[model samples]
Target: MKVIHIAGWSGSGKTTFILKLCSHLVHRGRTATIKHIGSHYCALPLGKDTTLHFEAGADPAVGIDDEKTSAVFHGICLDDALNLLSDSGVRYAVLEGFKGMPFQKVHIGILDGPYLLKNPEVSEVLSVLDQFDDWYTPSGLMKELTDEYPGCHIFSWAGYVTDYQKTKDLCSRIEDEYGDDPLIAGIRARVHRWSDDGRYPVYLLMAMNNPFADAAIFFRAIQKIEVCTLS
Candidate 1:
């Protein structure tokens, strides 16, 4: 599990960068992402029964629908969010916000001031997410995915990222192992935290050079490799 925190001031394109990062990961056929809204203003209207239930003292009143998007009234906590993703079994959770909280982060400041002195705890500080996916690849995975899937995006992960250094360190090793493969285009880690009460939401994927593989085989390869973390 790797956790890469994407942080910056308002209007600094934090959310936009997150969206693009999600796309790049998905194209590589890796599943990695966990977003934090940092706000509880998005509440359901009280005109409905769900709202009434919430007003009546239910912490989280869920409403499942046929659209495949389940609505959880009130808001979502980090643990709940992680459990949801764990159940889905994604490769990683590219979480948004939760900044300056002891995680490997990418801090984007406008003026590019003296950030090194600040204990912001970011592994990579860049102007944009595009800059981070700066892996050298012969084939253009981004362009191909753009043409083939259009707006569809992919996310991937290797199990358990608790800090930026851990995730970034593993990525460096992954690059050393399969950096030559055309499919191994880019590497980004999302900082995340989950619980053990329910099943884990994500299933880690293996570091592979070949872009094509059956899911079972990929799962096996992922299981064989051990994840290394930096403090």
Candidate 2:
């Protein structure tokens, strides 16, 4: 997931630009989510059931209907929201305001600041999409941990398997080989999307011992997985 912040003075066409960019992304078969930060306080209707539920101590109040579902969560910071979007497989995350936050920016109007684009069209932004910062995800977090701990031996795999039965057999084989091994500290396998054909974006992370522990004690945990065939 990538993050882009659209910032400018009030009434500077930020909203219009976002709509156009999102439409283009949809046409290209990519997913995008937006977060709008406003300066004023926006309140819900006084007698609405959702508002009542919030007033009755529900931290997050949700209302469901046929067309859409509305949810309001209190006390969540900006980074937390972006992480949620990344975990849900959003390809792009756009921010209407929040110029102060440190991320790539697309300035508008006569704003005096650093930006990747200034009042440019959607295609221009798409051409330079790689300039934006990547949002947080479990895989990214594990990579960061590996960088921090040089002694850690990490084996990670992500792929699209078109055979459902073969995927199951592979997972069972891994667990049977490593489930009782004391040296292995963590094993994570998740299917991000599944269909009749099989699963796409399956992620597996297996680490030997706790990388955060003393390096000397975990030195023996780096032994090779002799029975491992997922390489």
Top candidate on TM-score is 2
Clash count, predicted structure 1: 35
1-231 in candidate 1: lDDT tens per residue?
Answer: 234466677677777777766666565444556555555656577688777777887867656667754445455556555545544434345766666445545655552332231222222332233333221111223233334444333334435434544544544554465445444333322222333443222223233334454344434334433333323
Off by over 4 Å in 2: 29-32, 139-231
Give the total clashing residue pairs for model 2. 0
Q: Which residue pairs clash in candidate 2?
A: none
Candidate 1 off by > 4 Å: 28-40, 73-77, 110-231
**How much is 104 displaced in model 2, in angstroms?**
1.1
| Candidate 2 to native Cα RMSD, angstroms | 14.6
Each candidate's number of clashing pairs is 35, 0
Per-residue lDDT value at 195 in model 2: 44
Per-model C-alpha lDDT, please? 0.46, 0.65
TM-score versus the correct structure, for each prediction: 0.43, 0.60
